[model samples]
Target chain A: MDEKKLAIIATKGTLDWAYPPFILASTASALGYETEIFFTFYGLQLLKKDLDLKVSPLGNPGMPMPMGMDKWFPTLLTALPGMESVMTSMMKKKMASKGVASLEELRELCQEAEVRLIACQMTVDLFDMDPAAFIEGVEFAGAARFFEFAGQSDICLYI
Target chain B: MADFDEELDASGLNCPLPILRAKKTLAGMESGKVLHIIATDPGSVKDFEAFARQTGNELMESKEEGGKFQFLIKKA
Candidate 1:
């Protein structure tokens, strides 16, 4: 196969929504593809120091839980004590059962592959997120700047 | 005795993380060495399968038993 460059646009903040771009971008990098991940809208939460810490399962209908509980659990499960951790644990267990990697592992891969992670400046300003809340080394830029980078990519994904 | 020789416990991470970890782990492996990864993310079943095709990692096996995800990946 020919060498390819992939550009990932991570656009959501939920745990389920947050992981794909990071995973795909990392794999693309591993597969000898140059990769760039641009986080916009709620997607910037994944790069936040505290956001990824708490994965809210709001509006998650397919979330797996003990006793198939996620299916019947109240929509407000995210607000219950230890629910996020339980949910994150449930998610982690589910992913592990599927041969998926860990969050810690992904962080290392992001670093090792030098995956360029950028946060959309407009989203941050609109959300009123403190600049200091994000992970270190996040490239802060505008949509035009990000598109300039994506223009050169062979794969462009929005998620 | 090598890092590549052991099973990688990637269980408990969400999507993309499981795949990301596998990629990094595979990087240090010699081509043809088998790397094991265990995850608990349901999305991983799809994520890893897609990852295998994209990265050319031979996903020799993927099984989900009692809520645990397991795989034997051969570095290509």
Candidate 2:
């Protein structure tokens, strides 16, 4: 039987948004599907060597307040200085306590599984980012190259 | 207790971690060998079933005891 393939386009850069692509790709690989992720736009941040991903609660009503403060927490407070860092630390702690894999770990698993990691060359040049800023084993390519693989994939997703 | 060739303790992990660990363990085992797994995530019940179905691994047993989920998967 022919191997199944999964193609993904990751376009977000926030802390919360980083998990889906790596988690899905690694899991898909574990499920015996050949997986590839094309990192474009803000998603290029995920490929950087230093992962400083943060989550901002501003304008996000769905963000639950920490320390049982959700019921009465005001949205305006999320705009205060350093609130993003506070929320980011809290989220990191929560995820660590819950045994959720770190973004780095998941990405490493994807690499170990041989899931193709492709960086959008156009986005890199447009943002004036150096290719060396990314981790090793990343293939620099464009939309056409991604389409060559995605067109034949059994599943394709944009995240 | 069904006999198993390997044991994977995935306690405290959530979502895809448990399933991923199981998959990695199964990959190194020979076909027809049973793998016993213990997980704490409630979602693993359905996730393991779906994983087995998609990967062709045989889920020999799946049960819960005292809030922990257990699964015996025979490698395909």
Candidate 3:
């Protein structure tokens, strides 16, 4: 049998949304699958050097309130300035306490496992993001290049 | 219990960590050597099964006791 391959498209830029693609890609690589992640649109923010990722609760009805507080509290807080950054920090702390790997650690493990991280060239061009702005080991590729890998992948995910 | 060449305690680690650590451990071991892993995550049950299937490794034993999941994997 041929080797299994997984291709993931990451389109969301939130700190919360960043975990799935990286975790999945790294796990797939550990499982002996050839894994690739195509970062597009806002997702390219994750590749930014020294990026301070944040999550938005303003329009997210599903965003959980801190300390099991009333939903209205979080809703009201979201309307206030700088609340998203507060929530993002709290979320990071919560994840750390729960033994979840930080985004940086996960990315390092992915690199060691040789899971390919591909940035969407079109998005980079649209955002005027310099290649030097991205972290080391990130590759730039177009949608055509992404589809080439996705076409042969056993699993494809849009996260 | 069968003899295992290595033992890793992955309890309290969440999704993907246990599997990733196990994969790294297996990479440094000789073929046919068994690795015993104890994980607390419920997801590890499916994760280990899938890991073994995809990597062509032998899942020699798997059991759940005292809310902890145990797996013995032999490198291919």
Candidate 2 error regions (>4 Å) = A67-71
Give the number of the best model, judged by TM-score. 2
What tens-digit string does per-residue lDDT give for candidate 3 at A49-153? 776898877888887767665365646667788887788888889898887988888988999999899999999999898999899999998989999999999
Instruction: Judging by TM-score, tell me the better candidate of 1 and 3.
Output: 3
Instruction: Supply DockQ values for each candidate.
Output: 0.33, 0.86, 0.83
| Alpha carbon deviation, residue B63, candidate 3 (Å) | 2.7
lDDT of 1 by residue, A1-159 (tens): 887888888888776676677677776776678888888987888887765544656666665667867777787755778877877877766767765665556655776788888989998889898989888888999889878878988989999
User: Where in model 3 is the C-alpha error above 4 Å?
Assistant: A74-76
Q: How accurate is candidate 1 locally (lDDT)?
A: 0.77
Cα deviation of A142, candidate 1, in Å? 0.7
Question: What does DockQ come to for candidate 1?
Answer: 0.33
Question: Which residue pairs in model 2 clash with each other?
Answer: none
Task: Write model 2 residue lDDT over B8-74, tens digit each, in one string.
Answer: 9999998889998898888899999999999999999999999999999999999999999999999
lDDT of 3 by residue, B1-76 (tens): 6999999999988988999999999999999999999999999998899889888899999999999999999999
**Per-residue error (Å), model 1, residue B51:** 8.1
